[model samples]
Target: MRLFIEVPVWLGDTIMASVAVENVMTHFKGAEVVVFGSKVATEVYKAHPSVSSVEVDESKQSKNRWQWLYQKTKTLGEFDLAVSFRRQWSTRFLLWCVNARQKARYRRLDKASIHQVKRYNDFAAHVLGVALPLGDLVLPFAPHSFARPTLGLNPGATYGSAKRWYPEEFAKVAIALSSTHDIVIFGGPSEQDIALEIETLLHEAHVTNVQNLAGKTTIAQLCAYIGGLAWFITNDSGPLHVSAAYKVNTVAIFGPTMNTETHGWHNPNERIVKLDLPCQPCMKRVCPLGHHACMRGVKAKDVLDKIALLA
Candidate 1:
């Protein structure tokens, strides 16, 4: 069978959707899957064993987006089944334009609370007309081996400052763990400055076994490097989910976002570190109230304590 899957646009959502995609792949054994999404999101499936190809969407950049999308969908020919994990009108339009014998698109559930992974899985099960157990977040990159244990610090939260913990706190965690484990800082292009600040703090403390890898890695390289970590300390960001996909022992710092809804799905090794603040779950791009106490209240010691337990 040939399957066309439209993954979510964000890096984290794309990873979470892997659970559903894996289930669909298992149900239709030996199905050749083709994924379409943003460049960053599509990268998650580039190394997937079940995926035949990944097409990065460029319609957003085109002068005539609908025309571009129509042309793009036309060139793909036909698929046995097409599924979209997104609820946007554009995705619905794509589902209509694509030539598939069967098609499915996500519909929001009325449940009070549901993890993103479970929601995606429920959608897949609904499409398949049967229930199945949830699957792991799938990334097929081989883990890199290090001579000494390595600790990864991800201080970048693309959502906003509301979701980010302090870089100083992250550096403190790195300094404490640096005695036994090599420290590697991870971030995207927009987060390079924050990663650099953490690196600077570590250097000021005379920590030499540290690598600042912000803005230096492709999504694939990030997966390979993160797959090898003995431990990962991160904000609720894309890399946090990436670490979960690899089953890396992780300390996920949460602030403005709701952990219950977006925390690592079915990863026993992952631990969430968050303060139960009234202002939490605000889900704002920036903190509504001037003080970002939701994030500020969480100390490096809190994260380190969780890592200690995981260790």
Candidate 2:
């Protein structure tokens, strides 16, 4: 049988949805699985053992953007099963065009509050006719090689600045940790400035072996780098969940977002640091008050202390 899967759009969401991927693969066994996703999401699934082909939606909008996209996917022919992790209308329309024999869309449980991984797993279970046990993310590779001991710092959040920790504080923490471990910074194109600022501060502090990989590596390369890290200290962002998938020791700093919903999915090595502010967990892209006390209140030492305990 042939299957088509449309994964979530965000990096973290895609990683978390791997539980469903595993379930679908298990149910179908030898079926060919084709995945549809964004560039980064495509990278996340490219190395999956069960995935046959990955189709990325790299189309930049023009006069006939939807038509172009529809035409691109039309070449896939008929699928036996199609599963979508998103509820958006565009995704629904795409699945409609795929012309699968049977289709399943993700539906949240009524009045239920759970991690996204569980939600994805539930959808897969519903489709597969069994509740599959969720497990750690299934990457194409084994646990990473640790030729050089390193610590990874992810200071930027793609959603917005509200979710990011202070860059200066990240530099301070990196400077302190650099004496014992090599530091590697991670980010996307939008976060290059924050990563570079940390690099400059580290240089001024006479710290060495700091590699600013922000905007320098692709999503696949970033996942490989994350696998090799001794510890990953990051904000509540995409890389944080990536580290969790690799089972890396990660300290996630949470501010405007709730930790329960999006924290590391059952990873024993995961640690979360957040302050209990009145307006915290605001869930805003930018702090409406402009002070950003939720993130600002967290100190570098707090993150370091959490790392110390984990070590």
- lDDT for every model? 0.90, 0.86
lDDT by residue for model 2 (160-229), tens: 8899899899988888888788889899998899899999999999998888899999777888889778
Please report, as a residue range, the 10-residue window in candidate 2 with the lowest summed lDDT: 138-147
User: Scored by Cα lDDT, where does model 2 land?
Assistant: 0.86
TM-score attained by model 1: 0.97
Q: Which ten-residue region of model 1 has the weakest summed lDDT?
A: 107-116
Tens-place lDDT per residue, model 1, 115-224, is 88999989999999999788788887788887899999998888788888999999999999899999999999999999999999999999999999999999989988
Model 1, residue pairs in steric clash: none
Model 2 alpha-carbon drift over 4 Å, by segment? 59-62, 142-146
Name every residue pair that clashes in candidate 2: none
